[model samples]
Target: MSARSKKINNMAYGKLCLLLLILSGLSLTIHAKLSSNFYSSTCPNALTIVKQEIAKAIKIEARIGASLLRLHFHGCFVNGCDGSLLLDDTSTLLGEKTANANNNSVRGFEVVDNIKANLEKACPGVVSCADILAIAARDAVVYYGGPFWKVKLGRRDSLTANRSAANVFIPQPSFNLSNLTSSFATVCYKLYVVLGLCGHTVGFARCTSFRPHIYNDTNIDSAFAKSLQNTCPRSGNDNVLQPLDYQTRFRFDDKYYQNLLVKKGLLHSDQQLYNGNKADSLAKKYAMKQGDFFKDFAKSMIRMGNIKPLTGNNGQIRTNCRKPN
Candidate 1:
């Protein structure tokens, strides 16, 4: 190729890279706004304190890791990782805790409170609850054997929680692949939805949330459906739990994709990814390549954590995670 042709090709490549960076929620400007070392000087021990607390919680109960991750995901989805979901029901505010998607489902708030208290003792009013959520989420995934990536900090807490936004934003178990993609589209791309759902790789879902899939969905394997039917009947037993990845419920791995490939996915939305659709090939690739899944998952987590965060003077750093100062 001529020199001029090579130069034009390089220019096109640069533009493509820029587009990808913006679409993936990793714009250079956004990275500048939030940094991995945001608290290096103000609170040098912030990350350590969070990691130790998360490790202790996960050690006590392996399921807590998933719970902590879920808390962060839900909070981020509704209010841009602002810790609004951590808020209790104030006299005039309806917290995201009671939203349709999170009510009685999302757990591990006590874990956040513990981390916040420890951080306060070490450096009072130095760390933001929003940043705590982000770091705790990364540590939770790491504790469960998932990939680790630097969690950009400097986020501030939201003064109010939005129950309506939570219900509308957080993807539900009943969602189809298209719905999931649509839900994530405003904040991320299709790949983001696929990788983000890997949160199920380490967590358990309530019976009520997945009952229809087991009892009525034809896509699920017969044995898998029959096995869950006893515990999750046609009626009642709403809170009975079942691991999302039946293969390795507590382990953070690519078994989620493998499950979908075999019609054993525990949720309707999960199976939707593999029904001879665009996501089918992607699922097969991840099922066969655990390393690729981990790498993409870590990137997706960082991208998800970047959604519309309140930085600089836009929001306050709350002393108590459940209430704004």
Candidate 2:
């Protein structure tokens, strides 16, 4: 054909390709908006109700596991909590068996899987498994009767699981304040900032219907309880106990700060959160601000869910959550 005709055909094809690209971009934008809207509208209600369901499941599972004396892992990876941590490597000779052990993390997954099944029935694949983990973590907190705050959703799962990440991320229950601060700092969260953040979730969880059972008292009746009565005399009544002591046991109360005033706090790391005149002032500020705490909790949960997620077939859907390939 003529060179002029060929040039005209090439131009037409180029224009057609550009048009298709534009259309694809627009479609993606619309889909993303719709997904966000769905997340906003459905997440809160589903989270609230599903949290209770998860609480029930975990509690029942915990009770059963306690009778069995099983150990469980707690906390999440940057992306979200993967129940795989609960798998018992001892159960199989070559790590090819199904994970059926009972730990809080495993129970939490069972609870979450139940929630996932329900959400799938309600909204199909719209809700991600990672969001279920976020909601279930809160629910697990509630199941242990710790605290139940509103968890923001739409978290994507991690394609890769990290045992090293687990080692790095999970805070030691008995960690000192400085070490705890370092743990938070690993994720760019400062200790003072974290204490403020904790005040949001911890205070709300305590004040609400949820309760957490705190354990390990090195000097509860002796030194810790005595300090409680000395600080905040109005709130501190008994020499052995105070409103603050109650805070440690109850996850849904502002008493954590109150308790901080008493024994100085449950975790050795927690003391740093309230130490120093500046930290003391921040603690007081957090103690007085309930609404601020709630708002911060919502924001933190949303941020937590977005950490290093796997997308677009980067991760696989395990037929069994406990068994990893």
Which candidate leads the pack in TM-score? 1
What lDDT tens digits, residue by residue, belong to model 1 across residues 202-276?
889899989999988889889989999999999999999999999998889989989998899898888887888
In angstroms, what RMSD does candidate 2 have relative to the true structure? 16.3
Q: TM-score of every model?
A: 0.90, 0.55
lDDT of candidate 2 over 1-325, digit per residue (tens): 8998976765554444324322331111111111223366554356656656655664554442211111112334322333334333542322211221111222334554566667766666556655555555555544443434555434344334434555565553345444444454434333224322353222111111111112234423345534433542433222222222343443444555555544446444454446553346545755676455444444444444344444445454343334433
- Model 1 scores worst on lDDT over the 10 consecutive residues at 23-32
- The TM-score that candidate 2 achieves is 0.55
Clashes of each: 0, 15
What is the Cα-based lDDT of residue 299 in candidate 2? 48
How well does model 2 score by local distance difference test?
A: 0.41
TM-score of model 1 (CA atoms): 0.90
